[model samples]
Target: MFKRNIFICLFLALVISCGGDGKEMISLHPMQEKMAYADHETIMLELNEVSGLNHHMPKSLLIIHQYLNNETTSGFITNDLSVLTTDKVQISTINDSSILILEPSNNRLIQYDIEINSYEIISDQGRGPGDLYFAEELSTFNDKAFVGMQGFQLSIFDCSMDLCVYEKTINTDFNNYSIDATEDQIYVLGISPFGNPQDSDPLNSDHNLFHILNYQGDVLNSFHPAYDDRSPLVRNRLSSGGMIKTYSNKSLILIAFDFFPYLYEYEAGGDLTNIFQIDNFVQPIYESKESLHSGFSAGLIYGNKTVIDLTTRVDDEWLFLRLYERRNIGFDHVNVTFTGDEWYTYLAYNVERRELYKLGDDIKTTPGDSRVLHVLDQGIMVNNDGKLKYITR
Candidate 1:
């Protein structure tokens, strides 16, 4: 995150009020406290026990003073970056000095030097001794690129050299939804295909949606974020509503759930720490489900559901969260677009202070499939016109 300090002078007025007894009192007022709208009543978050939290209130709010696409930002986006298609490139793993882009189609890893305005293709796609096959996940730790693919394969590419060299591959047993790592351990969000027997409601079978694995591809322990037993149809509706995102710092793992205003922290060795939550978000509707039609057809009995879809991108100091209230048809069944009270808001959780900061409604992350979006150290990748638009501090 590049910091260009813009100082603005403010006039502070002190008002002294004189009581009837001739006592003078300084007048004070509360600051804006309410963050945003929520699904239900605001659940006060009591985050008392947390460590390594150095959250500080922003001295100045961030604004998009410049845009970095293949243009502008004083040529920061660079010409080589223009070759990246919007569908193929990912901007989630960027830092202050460099920007990382992952092209899943070809299994290519690109890193752009922000200061020099240049790009380099670090990793290539292949199937030799150390190549990528079905590369579905990409994350960076130190100078290594962690690639997760089908057949439960985890590959590490050494990016210290000019071109990334495949170092080692760890085998696992998960169709990975997302995977990231630290120096000692790796975290995985595996997609479990669970279905009801026929049409009956399903019970909590103690399914583990979160998996913690060692570098050698062995599962140390699994976390079952259990939910109440609901019918498959109901479960399907609520499943897509909330988001489950993870963040790790080579040791500490922060797991955020959008169903409520909470984030769970864990050690690299799978020890649960503190469960952090925000006490002051506007309550959102979490349990609003209705049957579509009594008449049962094999395929399409169209219904509508609105969910508080939450997504997050983690940085060094702040874990950026974007919340969206999306209303769509159940299971994407009907081709017809369903619409309702769709809204979006942004919040930043200071990892150091263990506090939530309301990054005003000015700059926000766009709503999408909740895979790590175009996120940088101090900026967020804006949805652009077939181009990359980045907003930094």
Candidate 2:
């Protein structure tokens, strides 16, 4: 599968480099320095024995711990475990009392009602209407659920009531990581389906970046932000995966790159409004092409690269980013353990105030700290020794 994907990407690269439509993507310059938002308490969430996933609603908190195992536990933050599933699952909140758990392996969704403490399988597994397969990303906006599946497909379901019925499915061209929506428009963030011929270097080839679509999944506009050309092995490796969130009553969009240090803001009309560089945050160290193909496990890949684990929004004023920087540790040993040199940092930005602040002063990653799984209005949710904990201010 890896070789197949690489071949496909190479073929696409060649075709795009040769005959891609020369529609120039807009690039915006970034501010070199980031303004401090304010003094914030130190926040750190480290990985533990258990892996936890969570979704935060306005009035309720859902936690899933010991994931991808027979003993998986799903419940509210203030309550005991009420549900269990053997298959791996991703979750999204439909409301304060109900949530959807997607088992991508099985291509189905499980609806858990917090009020009655009951679980029900809501969607089936298939390519037909209302069915899902290999779904990776799920989110709810205005009572509608958007599910991003493999094969560059997006399925939309109306979950306004207790059950979610299939509303529509969108076949997208690019590979997307996250999805957001307002009342009338949907925003998808991912690598551009089309490559730029103007990019002189294949390593730094321009990615179309973000796309705006209507309820019908018709793309209205697309934006390509300015990024330093880097990745040596893959064309989109340096700028592919990122998170997008809607703010200011869904009139604006905020984007944070996984491998890059800049944050981008776009208007409703798809204009590159502002670009921000957080203070003390530097560019990521790219692994050499040979090192990347050296048979390292996912852990080693993460341990050797800088990555943004997650991004969240607080109302419309605050934007929070969780990032980690790991040491190279040398690629000599095929199977090596990660040392304690990794650093975890969180940055908070006040979009309204145009200020940014680092949440913690300590740069060292703590031992046995719970991994950050989700960000809520109350605090960060983590998994600690097979249990769930919320770190609040």
TM-score of each: 0.59, 0.63
Leading candidate by TM-score: 2
**Residue 343, candidate 2: how far off, in angstroms?**
6.0
TM-score of model 1 vs. true structure: 0.59
lDDT of 2 by residue, 201-279 (tens): 5444444667888887788988764343333233345454567878747467788777655566777777766666554
Q: How well is each residue in 198-286 modelled by candidate 1, as lDDT tens digits?
A: 42224343455578787787788887343432333333332323333344543566665444455666665556666655644433332
Q: Per-prediction RMSD in angstroms?
A: 16.2, 11.9
Q: Model 2 shows how many backbone clashes?
A: 4
Error of 2 at 382 (Å): 3.4
Model 1: which ten-residue window has the lowest total lDDT? Answer: 27-36
lDDT for 286 in candidate 1 is 26
lDDT of 1: 0.49
By summed lDDT, which 10 consecutive residues of candidate 2 come out lowest?
A: 1-10
Off by over 4 Å in 2: 1-77, 84-91, 101-108, 192-207, 225-233, 248-250, 288-305, 327-338, 341-344, 357-370, 377-381, 384-393
